[model samples]
Target: MNKYFLKTTLALTIGFSSLGMLPGTSQPIEVEAATTNTQNNNQAVAAKADQLIQTGKSLIGKSTYSNTVYKPTAPYKFSCATFLMYIFEKNGVDLATYNENYMIQQGTYVTRNQLQKGDLLFFKSKKTGTDPDHVGMYIGNNKMIHMADSKQNIVISDLNSKPYYTENYVSARRVLPTLMSANPATKGDKIVQNAYDLKNKVKISTTNNEKYLRFTAPGFVEYVYQKSGVNLGTTNLKAQMNLGKTVSRANLKKGDLVFFNSVKGSKTPSLVAIYAGNHRLIIPNSDGVITRVLLVDYYNEHYITAKRVF
Candidate 1:
């Protein structure tokens, strides 16, 4: 028999044995014996139930990424929100089309105490209010798989850590079908891989009349122009600049923010952007537009460390 079936059968058998009272038995000795057997069986069933629970947990933990590239059964590549959508899809749950707006609209929007494994965590940098700036897959124990700014890349993080996220904790959304599934591997692995790829491909540029400062490097420039509603490119550059300060490049990640020194000892770094893993930065240099550039070129003399903003 399959492991699941075998375990179920064993548990039932133990439960039945514990209730040792047999039909058509009026004798005191037989009744006493049945009661004793029933107690023993009950203990055995409890032990078996605990073991099965632990085994299931272990299997869930093992369902993680290998080096292989994931090709979703669906057309689009996986993302933070898309990953959850896929899990629900695989489990036979039909959701609205996979989009950021759709997910946000469908999400339950609960507090941290309501969070469980396989929930979605949202964050923002604004202090007074909770504006959704970033999204991540919550994997339990206060850890999540956020795009993690432009420098940190797609990695796990603690929700209660640092300045911005800790204070700006928005809300957690639990995708139900995932909890009902037998396997969570495909969804989990795809989410992590997609987050990593997103980090690599993030490009920062200029928009909304923002000035694009041409750095000395070929095809590279600092996106000095800032405008509303523009997507910052990489994570590294974002981490450095999120705090409006300079940080060491060595400590940067794919989704981190970056900053450059235009003026000495100034709180605001002259140029700010996101770190796109592989030594690239994305910034909004043009008016209301974001662009991407090489890190070495952008920070040749003005290289600075990064800080976590999400």
Candidate 2:
């Protein structure tokens, strides 16, 4: 049991106001539309949001809620905040902690009338007093899905269906933008997308072929760049590291080549990976499978330098 989960309660019903198009907005004007690449990126992010909602829906009957305890693994057991932590982490957006007060402090505040799907909803109930004690994901149509209290497992409820939600609603925070903004439709996004597309589809080998290989971390980065029309020209990690404009770790954009010292305490670069934005890296494992992983702990500690080649 944790202090954060104490005094939690569930409100059975709720509802939200609908937002419709403005009354006089019925004509197309001569204006440029969002770039095709950006549109695609937005679509991809939106798809991820939909997937987040579906993931929460899938846990409905299988998850058990408890205000007194939190079990981080499945078969699942959760508190309201931990439930958000689980679903968001499953979709690659780490909420980081299972504390509602801390979570409410994250992302950016959003007005209740402007709530969008995937926004985190925080509320204060009679038991929780002035502090926000409950959290849930806004799942469009003025509805939200949450691990409602010890009585209700994971379930959905209309926001306006009960006065408890409307009257006590504390606030909402928009975290989807954190994921979406990192993937704006730039050439780098295309390169990162190519890397993702090639994950398990390519063969890693020392022999070079027309279809692509010279298999090594450098080769994988080269292949992904070539597919997206940028040629790095060398298979040597150190040589590749020297080919592009030098970039600091903090300014790295998607598709930037992040070089690292493979040997502990060595300054020379022995490995390279693609920066996939939002602090994620696209690199291959020993078994030759490419994967996206968080850039924390191990990778952060082995940091050498980065370069923007694309």
Candidate 3:
């Protein structure tokens, strides 16, 4: 882990009080927005959170952290709190807080069991002293992405498996409503468009023919989502199924992940697709390219849960 002293630098861009929505003090968070009257607004909120997570995850290994300088304009070390401030403000959230303690308390507190994707998780550390000295964003399940320290930079960790996180874990809070950009539903639409955009770009190929690799069944599915800023983690059918929020088939949305139990009549999903609004889903044909399939009979028969990963 990278080490940092509790020293402040004059180059720090934001103080604890200078944020989009300052609560008490410390770090920054995506504050809750007023309840929206339209489904579009709700979609917008989801879209923004999805984007934030994607953007944050994408920054892993690229961002550096420091206890001194707080230049968030890239090429600067980001402390635990300033790292979040940089990510939020960089992605249109407009937040500027840099105190870990102040940042975690910026949203409504939620129980551990009630935690969802895009929640702010706080931890107290000797390095930070008082309040929350360390912070991270809950991605999904028990996984989180945070700036570990000066050595590790940005990384993803399993909250359930890590003893350090479990010991220091203080609370989780909801913070996505305010960070939303306009037309988040468009993110889903773009994901759909990404699938179609590469419809014929790839075709099924095996190791014997190394060139047509991106055109494989699972590859097609993963590539489409990757184009939209979300990585499904792996191309394995079963592994991919466990990546996002599992939604009922009846509740499938445009970007919902649809799956099917195609072999041995297994109860688990064996194949997957991107739900494309209406009754259609985008899947790979035998050639390993994008094809539209309807959940009419065959798919509806083998359909499993639709997971909303983004």
Candidate 4:
């Protein structure tokens, strides 16, 4: 709903030129690396596009459009930008803001000929003039799904079928390549998935006598891992240190047990959390709510070690 004018030129160039294989070897070292990265990116983008499209489609007729405010919860109500934000976050990609002008500057720019599924298309209408005031997702086949207006709510429209869309087309941004931090395999990670499901739903309080509130920091870690078919046998903090092979901080993977020393003089770990990839940790906050926090500063200074059980 925040309004502003487009600050940059919309004309963009594509940068993904393929490289030929090297001599002697079927593929050069650099070619192999580039190919691998491209393949991984393609897989990630495809999965994210499917997820975003399906989620948006599911909300059609059930959701309403609003350009004045943003509704973060269910019984969906959204603006053009906020709608994209909601669907992207639901699929583990965060667009970070709901302002169309600011969002117009995110990620890489894609030419019309290179348009792919999941690319965000920005447009300007008569009311907005040349400023980027509207946004939607390119759902392939030269079509886009957007929160058109209050009357239409959420609907799919053809880009070429409408003269208004073609005349007002401003630019497009490909965010899936950069926003989708995890590959397709990470979506299939049972440990990570289980941890995500338990976020904000479980408690970390050790002293609460409630039947459903018996989880400590270690207990929470143990429960999530156990739910994923990996049994650490005990919730004891020290016992967990020897449960799995040690993993270096640089080599840490998602779902690894990241231990930290909470007490000043304690040599062993007093707290444990799951590494949720992208420098994020899933740990219980002081209020006993399971949440995610960046693993920096305080976490960096109190770093102990990590273990990969799965």
Q: Please name the candidate that would achieve the greatest TM-score relative to the true structure.
A: 2
Question: Per-residue lDDT of 1-310 in model 1, one digit per residue for the tens?
Answer: 0001112111111110111112354211111111111232435333332332222222222123221222232122233443333333332222323333334444356678767554666665545433464566666677765434324434567777777668766677654432221233233223222322222222334222223322311112222111111233433433335444444666655445556666555554566555544343444332222223342333656655575433
lDDT for model 3, on a 0 to 1 scale? 0.62
lDDT of 2 at 45: 54
lDDT of 4 by residue, 113-221 (tens): 8999989999887573555878999999999999988898888999988887999898998886654334444521557657655654666676432358457777777
lDDT of 3 by residue, 128-242 (tens): 5456778888888788888888788888899977778988888887766532322444677778656654544556543122244455566667777777998876777778878
Off by over 4 Å in 1: 1-79, 87-95, 126-131, 177-310
Worst 10 residues of 2 by lDDT: 10-19
Q: What is the TM-score of each candidate against the true structure?
A: 0.30, 0.57, 0.45, 0.50
Each candidate: RMSD: 23.7, 11.6, 20.5, 14.5
Q: Residue 19 in candidate 2 has what lDDT?
A: 15
Q: Which lDDT tens digits does candidate 2 get at residues 97-142?
A: 5667667766788999998888999888756456587889999999
Off by over 4 Å in 4: 1-39, 72-74, 126-130, 182-310
lDDT of 3 at 33: 34
